[model samples]
Target: MLELLGLSRVGEAVYRSMLANPRLDVGALAAETRLTERQVRTALDELADLALLSPVSGDGALRAVVSPEVGLAALLASAEEEAARKQRQIEQTRAAIAAIAAERSAGRSGNEIRRLDGVEAVRARMAELALTATRECMSMNAGAADRPDSRAASAPLNQQALERGVVIRAVCRESFRNDPETLAHAHWLVGLGGQMRTVPTLPMPMVIVDHRIAILPVNPHEAAEGAIEVDTPGVLAASCALFEHVWATGTPLGDAAAAGDDGCLPQERALLGIVADGHTDEHAARKLGVSLRTVRRMMSDLMERLSAQSRFQAGVNAAKRGWI
Candidate 1:
């Protein structure tokens, strides 16, 4: 119990012995604790440092323990004060860093920015931001450049941050769901507890962490050219607002292919939803995990069920019946 209060084993032994025998000296403590006199002196010095043991009088040979209640509470209070001071220092340092960045860009012309010169640098910046983001990280994938390796590299980051209770929201273009590979990446992200949504289109491949930093590719198709990191309040704030607006309009993936009041299975609803989202038959088939012929057969079945002559009419009829 005293060890929990930061007393070392020897110090605790010495203190306990001293408490039991209020007039015990260092030599008596050593004998009682089965410790050498030198070891007992060391323990006594430790206890004295912690204020658990104080000189009994002007004489240095004997000592007494302050009550555990008072001594331990004092130790805890000191620890808390130290922790609070460190926290304050950390906040101040963060403020200084922000101020420095702001000051550096204050007088620069044409929207101050820093160029992220290479793929490695961009990835490093992303890792840094993800590590620092305490509250949330929002992302958008507007391009179709999600290679297997890139997605794989992001797996651990997404998994760890999600486990850390970070609120992760990602938005991808509707067409991305049609690519089997991209859909696999989405599924991977979802498995990590990330909330993914789809929109008709996205602005670009970008990440906004904590709404304080925004990372964007210079060119959606040519990311190798470089990237940009935006920290200016106006730009960051606008980007944050835009993300929220888009998120509000995006359809959550699980519900993206969700069935309606028509009592359809999720797969059928996924097929209908994919079709309604403007994917071609081949793309829809790929997304639905079926063959082109199967997609055609399903569409024919849907058309027959709705009593429609054409595929478009079938969709219209389904909508009229509140199926899509």
Candidate 2:
């Protein structure tokens, strides 16, 4: 036990022996402790170094053993002070590391934007944001959120946020209902008290946590590249506004998206608007989170329903009927 105060076992034994038998010399201490005289003398030197042994006045060959209550207490107090100093140093080092990290991040894009270089990095940042979120987590995702792998990866983070009583509101494409697995995942989210809504198309994928930070794809057309984290108040406000505007026009996950009076589903009407804007079928498929084949099939059906011979005529006919 005394070793913790920097006393060796041999020194501790010699000190205890000297304390209990104050009249004993080094030779006698060695015999009592079953140690050699040299070892005993070494312990005496150790004790002297620790100020546990003091010379007796008028007796050059004799030394007095300090009481444990005094010597050990001083040693313990020194050890405690050393430990506290180390703790302070550790805290300072931690602060320095945080500052260095912030500086490195800011060097890339002012403090308002941080670039995540890969998919793994983006996921890691999102997970961190989810863990630290205090109030709400809102997201507008394209088709990726409906993929089995993406859903599996996000389940735990979503559950953790929900369990923390964070309000989670998500918007995805209405095309997710066509896939049974995606629809089941949507139901699971709703069952957990999270709000799930769908729109005909999403402009981009984004996540806003606590209304403070927003994560957006670096390239909306190529989401797998990476993402950027934004904390600028103006950007966050715009992101929140975009989410709210889309949310206001969304169909809740539990309900079916009703078609307009023109016999075109919202997605179908959205397809018409995209065609009218002169976007390719591939672009429309990407925006609607559907396959190119599906987009072509919808276009063909629309053309047949409108009795139009060509794509341009279909758009004209649909507009005439107020379908657009």
Candidate 3:
């Protein structure tokens, strides 16, 4: 296993032996493993160089395996730092190429529409644009809440943009609020000062930076395949319009509930309506696309608010408040 960290197989065997028998000397390690004394000594020196072993205090020939928690983590961190340095070099080279290509195409394509392949490349470009956004960032997430990882991957960049005072408004499918994981991400983004809303559905996943550039999936579903970025006035306007149309139909997650202000929210009111129509908790949860647990919790909250002992009384109180 240590070979995975660039240790030789012999070195790994010696390290394992030392870990198993901390007081093992070079001769004992060689006798315990399949190596000769000379090979064991060589492996010990190699392991020591990699910080995999520490010399014991009392005996010159005694060494112990460094605890993996410290030794392995340090090695991994060093590797990561080196990889990050190389990535910086690669980014610089890519920037130089992009600059030269842009100069060459300066007069050829007016308000050029660029196609980017792969999700990583597309996300990198989005991050690049976000770095320059001075106004606003608008996004439509289609069914983003369906995928648990979608929000986490972009949360840092989104938060950075928010910190830059860029207004971010995002709309996702209403079912997003039904799932705890999805709701958590939406609330997290809201906590970072980005506005989030939920709608029944959306046309596609898209992002418009400062209303100057819009990035869209070329095949919507297979976003990993590629994306098309639009910057021309006409196309950009149409994309922004699409987002606005969806936005108009969405309910902002943050401002949608005033818990104590009104007795019920729009969704909670719908829940009451479902209950009024004589639906069971399971039926209501199915209708709302939420789990049965969530439906029960909502009912419990409603019952407490109305000072009711039963669902029937909760409905009666809701009716009195015109919530149903």
Question: What's the TM-score of each model vs. the native?
Answer: 0.52, 0.65, 0.47
Model 3: lowest-lDDT 10 consecutive positions: 254-263
* Native-structure RMSD, model 2: 14.1
Clashes of each: 0, 0, 0
How do the residues 258-313 of candidate 2 rate in per-residue lDDT, one tens digit apiece? 88777789899999999999999999988898889999999999999999998899
* Best prediction by TM-score: 2
Clashes of 1: 0
Of 1 and 2, the candidate ranking higher by lDDT: 2
lDDT of 2 at 312: 95
Quick one: best lDDT, which candidate?
2
Off by over 4 Å in 1: 1-6, 13-41, 57-62, 111-115, 123-138, 141-204, 208-214, 218-226, 229-242, 249-259, 263-324
Model 1 lDDT tens row, 81-150 = 8889998997787567557656754667545578899898998778766655668999987654377777
CA lDDT of every candidate: 0.76, 0.88, 0.79
Q: Rank the candidates by TM-score, best first.
A: 2, 1, 3
Candidate 1 lDDT (Cα, 0 to 1): 0.76
Candidate 2's displacement at residue 275, Å, is: 1.0
Weakest lDDT window of 10 consecutive positions for candidate 2:
102-111
Stretches of candidate 2 off by over 4 Å are 1-111
Report the lDDT tens digits of candidate 3 across residue range 1-324: 655476899988888888888888778888999789999999988989999888767746566789778888898888888889998996687567657656654756657788999978887887777655669999887653456555666777777678868899988766677578878877888888889887644567899988878898988767779799877999899998999988986788955533435646656877888898898998776555567898899889989988899888999998888776
